[model samples]
Target: MNSSKPERRKTREVRIGSTAIGAENPVAVQSMTKTLTTDIEATIAQISRLENCGCNIVRVAVPTKKDTEAFAKIAAQVNVPLVADIHFSAQRAIEAIEAGASKIRINPGNMRSWQELDEVIACAKVNKISMRLGINEASIRNLKEDTPSRERTGLMFEEMSEYVREFEKRGFCEIVLSAKSVDVNRTIEINRKFSEGFDYPIHIGLTHSGLPEDGIVPSAAAVGSLLSEGIGDTVRISLAGKPENEIITAQDILASFGLYEKKTPRIVVCPTCGRCMIDVLSLAREIKQAVQEIQKPLKIAVMGCIVNGPGEAADADLAVCAGSGKGYIYRGGKKLAVVPEAELLAEFSKQINLLVAE
Candidate 1:
């Protein structure tokens, strides 16, 4: 019953195109494009899809100049801010920066030397682009060198700190820090250390996760753990399937903790038992599909039994407690009308639609 809000960590704000992240801004939800960045049309279409799903920022991979060429056009056509994912290649990072990337993600462990970093940082500074110093576990040399699992977070912290210091030394302070591991505990610990030591915004995610269907639980666990304590600024749910699914996954995590900006009715349906009447499961599914796009913050309840229905849904904006062949509609615990079973869903839909319009 406790709904205490978590305190967010204060960090420097970094701008990506038109979007502002960190500095206690509403935690931004982001996802990546799965299509090859060289496929300009498909990449733009996917970014548009993610934008429609309430995604705040989107990252696209730029492994080569061709992708950056496509990225230039993609950035011109899309409204959401774009981050170019660059691996160890400094040349590619510079190219993506020139092509209009609002932000660039670089793995600190993968970079060869300070000179290589200086090249990319100089380019980012000139272009006025923010940088995400992504410290990934798999890419880290210490982790690959038979480092004990328990010591990985420490190594990540060390690596991230070194990169952040380098960025500052070069006079490029528009930095966002991220430390990601497949293990949720490591991800949480590394970010906690990062937050305590620096004021830069931190991006949160798991580097390698299972397939989309199987990835949500762990990805949510890692991201939600950090965000709940106010340690994360931007989030990406790294899933193994359609990149847009990552947006939905990220939304579910942020919404569970009440940190997301995009709001809609969250309908609660009773898991029916023998005390139940009416087909609550079918009705709930249909209503969920219908209201997926509504942005208004509303709580709805579809209960199969009348005994604990209205009282349980007392906080809901709208509710329908169904009986054997009739249903009672309630608004904020006050009954409005009785309707036949077949019309219950129809009436409930109309009531919520009216509420949304209001």
Candidate 2:
């Protein structure tokens, strides 16, 4: 399916500010602002950078009235839709809606009573905004003691399903559901079960995926698996780094499944072994740095040996198959030249320049 088009899961399309999610829409990439919500300029700058990095949506924390005030100003200035993250307060949720938030994220399981939850839903309906109704395991009330893995994920499904129905009962349908756990497999499983039981759009991501280097794999395995199976409509890779890095990681996941077709560069490096004579890792690192800013959908491969390198290089737009003392250059899958090891960088750079120019 990576090489062919996939039949995406169908769900009711819901608009989040200027963009739409669910059936027939591209799976949106979103990230949160790391700056303080009270600092309008800093928050706006972060959102602008994320936008430049191709983030489809941005969320900001609104834990105080001052942040809510700043949020309104930021919304008025930014081009992309902003989602207000609300926790432990319903009045603040109402205030955020009035402040021009395109959507609001609230975990109903965290609410002490349905009274406040109902009021928030009413506010969203009145303001014509969308809601991301989530049921985080940590927030669930009175979770059955010593629950089995099956029952735990099922509980998540039940929590999300019940919350969604309650919103529908109050005549609110512009909803995106989420059920996440720090456990990657559980995140994947719950999202699938949640999707099968409802037609509402689902927002998928791992809860508190740690730092970038360690989080990338778990985030991808959870979010990427769902997207590949026609599950996620909108996504965020929750990481402890620059929010823009989350955008990069999310886009990379979408791109891997052929779901995203943005002008981003991709690198294909062979896992070097004893067969490798030249320094493959160092060359690949340099190549990664060199093409970081390239805004073209180019595939560059760095292979270690002629054994499998040439065959793999045949599939890239530009590639180099390094042998003992020389490297064979490939352009558009055809052998262009065989250069000495000392001249490999120059030849690879030349081919890349030509590709970019085209």
Off by over 4 Å in 1: 1-4, 144-146, 261-263, 289-295
Against the hidden reference, what TM-scores do the models get?
A: 0.93, 0.94
Q: Per-residue alpha-carbon lDDT of model 1 for 1-358, expressed as tens digits?
A: 2145578999989998899998968888888999988888898899999998888899999888788889999999999999999887898899899999999998866777778888898889899999988877877665666677668888877788888777788889898998778888888888889889999998889877789878888888888888778888898898888887888778777777767644667788899999888989998998888788888877888899988797866878888898879999898888888999999878888888888887
**Candidate 2, which ten residues in sequence have the lowest lDDT sum?**
1-10
Q: lDDT for each of the candidates? A: 0.85, 0.88
Question: What TM-score does candidate 1 reach?
Answer: 0.93
Global Cα lDDT for candidate 1: 0.85
Clashing pairs in model 1, backbone N/Cα/C closer than 3 A: none
Q: All candidates: CA RMSD in angstroms?
A: 2.2, 1.8
Q: How accurate is candidate 2 locally (lDDT)?
A: 0.88
Residue 313 of model 2: what lDDT? 80
